[model samples]
Target chain A: MTRFALTLEFDGAPYMGLQRQPHGPSIQQHVEEAVHAITGEQVTLHAAGRTDAGVHALAMRAHVDIEKAIDPFRLMEALNAKLRPEPIAVLGCAIVPDDWHARFSCLGRSYIYRITNRRAPLTLERGKAWQVSAPLDAAAMHHAAQHLVGHHDFTTFRSVHCQAASAVKTLDRLDVVRDGDGIDIHAAARSFLHHQVRSMVGCLVLVGRGKWSGEDLKAALEAKDREALGFNAPPDGLYFAGAVYP
Target chain B: MTRFALTLEFDGAPYMGLQRQPHGPSIQQHVEEAVHAITGEQVTLHAAGRTDAGVHALAMRAHVDIEKAIDPFRLMEALNAKLRPEPIAVLGCAIVPDDWHARFSCLGRSYIYRITNRRAPLTLERGKAWQVSAPLDAAAMHHAAQHLVGHHDFTTFRSVHCQAASAVKTLDRLDVVRDGDGIDIHAAARSFLHHQVRSMVGCLVLVGRGKWSGEDLKAALEAKDREALGFNAPPDGLYFAGAVYP
Candidate 1:
């Protein structure tokens, strides 16, 4: 059997998310079905990260093993051709060692949250960005986010549905930038607790709106209580940007 | 009657185009219907330009006369609220003099065409960008486009349906720039014939693909015949970017 690594880009509006869902359609289900059509094998697809509903992926990495002898380029072309009418695109394919697990071998992950900071209703960016009509001070958001860029107990910033054992994790980066009427928050970490990035972004926006301060963010971090969470940003603005490996 | 000028942004995938069509929905039709619902008046909406089907607009300028005494901010907010779920936004609204027309008062117009150069099919950019899978040399396309940046009889570039009295129009700018897997073609002029920008972009793509050269483009321009045109890029990649006023 030969293992193949696949890079995918998908719009999450139509699917449940990146991982498989028994209750609804997901990116993985469609991709695996396309693979089954091409190779006639019911192989499992492993992904680097699992995105929630309405969260997009720019370059999500996945892996699958096949017994059929197929060129990577031809496999990619066939998968793309078969995944038509769906929003998923197989960007790349490459042969990998059997032990190169897409999930376990990943060292780090990054996500970017997009916010459209404008009073006007979103047109071109609808469903792709979070439209915040209230004026936000991005500088304040950046300053407050600095408190989150280190090792800390982030119980307050995690989702109730998170399956991670420990809330204590190290955050590598959390940077907020403003461009025109848009605000982008880039977050990187070894691994994030479910909803950690969205929870952090929500509080940062509160600080940007002057509803909270940097001291408040730090206090919430120290509290380690879920009830102390300020807010949870919607999944619509989140995107799985990339995965890093050793 | 107070004339209110509106700066609009829209995703043109839903409507026929920006103008009111006899058989189809349009940006003007929806905006006018919203105004009638609010003020009970049959007011006409004048736009800076007419876009073909599926051509988006970033900030197309337009004007409508409203007899109801309403603040610009309120008007903008109400219009946005009324045009809900239509992928149209009123970015700005201001009172303009009666003599200032959205179409005639414009000194220049600018457009941007987006091309995604990649092997993968588009997902997030479906109906929004033209996808070219073949290798494209943007520098070669830029060099060929420079030949179009002056006063000339552009019958070869103009559409058969173009109603301009004269085919001679000075093109102020035609620039091609590549960013990652995307190519953007920027065009500016006082006025352009129907399909002029798309025709120019199609020939530029041919030049980028080595199917044509700068000399061929110059010869096409000199031919000044509609049959001399190479191709016309689809409306999906074209955007009515902005309008210049003096």
Candidate 2:
């Protein structure tokens, strides 16, 4: 069997999540079904990250094994063409060794959260960005983000349903900056638990709005309690930017 | 009656045009209806530019007469509050002289046209940008755009339904540049004939694709014939960026 790595871009508004569920559609099921239709082989697709519902992906990496020998570009084109009427596209494709796995071989993952901090309501970017009518202190938000840069038990920022065995992880970077009328939060880590990014962004947003202090954030992290965290930000502003492979 | 100058921003997808139309909803109708609902005044709103359907406005200027005595900021807030559920917003408000007119008192009008030149189809920005799956030479497009910068009879680019009395108009500026994966066409003039911006962009796109030369554009302008133009680009990419007043 030959391993193929595929880069994907999709609008995550219509799917339940990356995992297959009995109630709604999933990105993995559509991609696997498309591959099966083209190659007549049942392929299990593995992704670097599983984004929540209503999120988006600019470049998502996945690996699948197939028994047939096919051109990478042709396979990408065929799969993209078959996934028509759906808001998904195969941007790039390449062949790799059979041992290269999409999830286990990943080095890091990156995410970006977009927030429009404007007094007026969003029109063109209504469902695509988190809107905050009150003005935000971006400089304060940036200053507070530096406190969460190192490795720690991030139980306060993890989902209640997270299935990770350990609560401790290394955070490579966490940056917050203002761009035009919006604030962008860039986060990177070796890996993340469920709802980690959203939960952290929620607390930072509170800090931006003067509802929470940097001291409060520190205490919450030290508490190691999920109930001590702030509200989870909506999935609209979250994006699975990309993943790195060694 | 006091003359009020208002700054507006809107998504032009649901309107027929900026002006009042017999068949469908117009931006004027929405603004006027919202104003009447707020102050019980049936006033007509005049704009610096009359943008077409599917076009957007980042910052548009307008003027209206109000019989009620109201502060500019309060008027703006009340009008925006009453215009709930609409895709229009009053960004700013100012008091102008009685002689000030929205259309006639404008000094210059600026427009921007966006094109996403990429192989993959757009998902997030589908209706907000023009998607072209071919590579474009932005330098060639810029070189050709200079030919139409000075004063000339722009009949070749004007629509058959143009209502302007004279086709002779001076173009203050016309610039083409590439930003990341997109091409931006910026144009400024005292005024423009109907479909002038879209038609110019269409011809420039051909030049960017190496289908036409710079001299071909000059010849088309000199001919002053409608049939000499290439085509009218779609209205989706057009935006009334802003207006500069003296």
Candidate 3:
């Protein structure tokens, strides 16, 4: 069997997220079904990351094995055509080594959380961004975000249902900046626990609103308790930007 | 009666257009209905521009007359509350003189069109931007756009359905710039003939793709013939950004 790596982009508004669930429709089920229709082979797609519902992806990587030899371009075109009516697109396709797994071979992951810091409700960016009517101090949020960087036990920012064995993870970067009328929080790490990025953003939002300070974040990290953290940011603002390979 | 000016924004994917149409739902009908639902007053809203179907608005200006006194903030909040589920928002509201009309009193109007130039189909900006796989020379497009600026008879760019009395109009600004993977076209004028902006963008796209030159645009303008112009750009990329009043 030949392994094919596909890069994809999708609007996560309508699905139950990246993984296939018996409860509802998913990005994986639709893509796999499309691939099966094209190749006449039942294939399982292994994605680099499983994003939550309402969380978009710009360049999500996935690996699938097929028995037939197929041209990458044709495969991409056929998959896209079959996945029609669904807000998903196969951006790029390439042949990879049979042993190269999409999730295991990944070295890093990145995400972007968008927040529209304006008094007005979003029209154009309705489902795409988090709308905060109160003005957010991005600079303050950036300062507070710095404390959360580097290797640390992120229990305060991890979901209760996270399957990771330990809360300790290395954070390579956490950047908060203003773009137009919105504030973007860009995070990068080797890997992350469930809802980590959203949890951190929720705390940073408090900092932006002057309700919390850098010291408060530092204390939360030290406490290593979920109760110490602030609210969880809505899923609308989150995006699975991409995964990095070594 | 008190006259209130409102700055509005909407995603025009669901509505027919800015003006009330007998066939399909329009932004005007939605706003008017929301206003009546909130205040129990049947009021008509006059906008600075009547955008076509699937044409979004970033900062559309409108004026409404209320027979009874009302707080601008409360009225705006009530209208927004009632307009839920529809992608429309009242960005700002203010009390204005009876003489201040939404359309006639406008001094300047600005618009922006976004084009995603990439090989892949857009996921995030599917309806919000025009996606073209071909690589576009934005610098060349910018150079060509300069030729269309200044007072001139824009008959070639004007639509046959345009109701403007005169074809001659002053174009204050027309700029094409590249932003990341997208191209942004910004235009400003005292007023514009119907389809003028879209027509200009269509011609500019050709220029950017090396199919035409700046001299060709000049020739088209000088010809003052509809046949001289290129295709009209899709309404999805066009936005009524804002209206300026003196």
lDDT of each: 0.94, 0.89, 0.92
Give candidate 2's whole-model lDDT.
0.89
Off by over 4 Å in 3: none
TM-score of chain A of each: 0.99, 0.98, 0.98
DockQ of 3: 0.67
Q: Classify candidate 1 by CAPRI docking class.
A: high
Give the Å shift of residue B141 in candidate 3. Answer: 1.9
Q: How badly does each model clash, as a count of residue pairs?
A: 0, 0, 0
Top candidate on TM-score is 1
The estimated TM-scores of all candidates read 0.99, 0.94, 0.95
lDDT string, candidate 1, A52-122, tens digits: 98999999999999999999999999999999989999998999999998899999999999999999999
With a 3 Å backbone cut-off (N, CA, C), the pairs that clash in candidate 2 are none
Query: For model 1, what is the error of residue B115's alpha carbon versus the real structure, in angstroms, after optimal superposition?
Result: 0.3
Second chain TM-score for model 3: 0.98
TM-score of chain B of each: 0.99, 0.97, 0.98
lDDT of 1 at B121: 96
Tens-digit lDDT track for model 3 on A1-246?
889999989999998899998888899999999989999999999999988888999899999999998998899989888888688999889999887889999999999999998877788998899998778899999988999899999999999889999999999899999987889999999899999999999999999998998899899989999999899999898999999986
Best by lDDT: 1
Candidate 2 on A58-127: residue-level lDDT in tens? 8889999989989998998898888887888888899998778889999999999999998776666766
Clashing pairs in 1: none
User: Which ranges of candidate 1 are over 4 A from the true structure?
Assistant: none
Error of 1 at A31 (Å): 0.4
